[model samples]
Target: MKTKKMGIQKHYYLMMLPGMLWLLLFSIVPMFGIIMAFQDYNPGQGILHSEWIGLENFRYLFQLDDSKQVIVNTLIISIGKIILNLIVPLIFALLLNEVRSLRYKKFVQTVVFVPHFLSWVIMATIVIGIFGYNGVVNTIAGWFGGQPRLFMADPSIFRELLIGTDVWKEFGYNAVIFLAALTSVNPNLYEAAAIDGANRWQSMWHITLPELTPTIVLLGVLALGNILNAGFDQVYNLYNPLVYSTGDILDTWIYRLGLQNLQFSLATAAGLLKSAVSFILITVSYVLAYKFADYRIF
Candidate 1:
């Protein structure tokens, strides 16, 4: 028995060797910089000679006005995106499921999903063009006797702009996941409801949505873990200093501070804190998933 188990373990190691090596090179080695979050990192002194400040980086981060705004902007943008992303896609998927025309359904799905494949950098250009001072959207607003507000440039509107643009980009792709889950729900359930004289609305509310609850909860759990992400590419490309009050996220903040401004320790600490929070949230979610939902990840 022991020999057979040893052979199985040897085979597993052989299968995992390359993947483990890749993780070591890409993940573990880079993770060493997490230590810098505890140090007063300096380019001249390097990682080894850097002074260890322990929790000072965290203390400094909390004390700064910019950091407070940064955290607030991140949470608002992320939470808003989370709500819009889920509600819009799920609603879309539900509505699309009602369409009986295969050709039209496929065409709409294809068109909507296309944006997800495009890079945010590319989409940002399109967004700028549409929402610019004299772009198509602004021109349309002129017909309504309204002035063109700079959605991307205005601090007051930047959070909404981020949420709106992100929803536009990824909602269709998100719908595909919900659609797949929707497909798995038993067709007989719908048929039985119809035979029992249930209205389409009743079937949707009582049967369809209830069947979708587990998948929704699973996705929600995943989204909740990243309540701090707030999207770097979207914010970085779309934001100007005029809108930084509402548009700055932890990711964008870290990139600008760590890479561009070279505030290594401070930036790393911000990222580290986000990571710590995300880790705790994900851990708690998984525990709940197992305890309450009886779901196992592996």
Candidate 2:
């Protein structure tokens, strides 16, 4: 078996050469740049000559109030997004599945999916037009005897707005996965339940939901792995210093520290920390998925 495996390995390696080269050049080579996080890295000093500070960069980050806020905001935003992301999409998918009219079903699905394709910069402009102080939401609220509120400016509401917008943008794309899972469920189960006098709600609760558990669990685990990444593009586009207390996440914090403040070493350290946590989370999730949920992407 070992000899045969070696023979097949040669053929596999030959076929995978180009892709392997791409990964090496693009992914692996670039990761070596992470060494800057451990050093008082100077661009002129280059990688080898930079003064090594060991874990000083990480320690300094933990000592900073702004850094702590970044971590807190990242977790809060990500968790909020995760909950909303699953919920709205699941509800929409279930509702869409019930629609009898093919034309309306297609139209709703298409319209919902449109936002997923839009860039966050463009979406930010749309959000401003709808949620800014004079925007649609405040305008509607004003008509109801409420004062015009700054939705984006208020730190308390920024997280909510971020999660809501993310949900709106990504829900349709996520619904596609659920819709596919729903289609694969055996119709005979629904039929059997119907014959046994199960109503629509009962059949949905018993048949449809149980069939969706594995898929739900699978996606839940994947989302959990990404719980620190609250989205750079969205937050960067939508946020300002006014709401940074609640809006600054790990990625955005790094952007300010490195790009804006020119503290490249500190920013790199923060990024490396996030990447390390994400790596561990993803690995653990994959293991659990295989052991209990049988989640296989391929």
What TM-score does prediction 2 earn? 0.91
lDDT of 1 at 164: 92
Write down the RMSD of all candidates, one decimal each. 2.2, 2.8
Q: After superposition, how far is residue 228 of candidate 2 from its true place, in Å?
A: 1.1
Worst lDDT run of 10 residues, candidate 1, spans 288-297
Question: TM-score for every candidate vs. truth?
Answer: 0.91, 0.91
Q: Candidate 1 residues 43-69, lDDT tens each?
A: 899899999999999999899898989
Superposed by TM-score, candidate 1 places the C-alpha of residue 199 at a distance from the truth, in angstroms, of 1.6
lDDT of 2 at 115: 92
Q: Against the correct fold, how does model 1 do in TM-score? A: 0.91
- For each candidate in the order shown, give its overall lDDT on alpha carbons: 0.89, 0.91
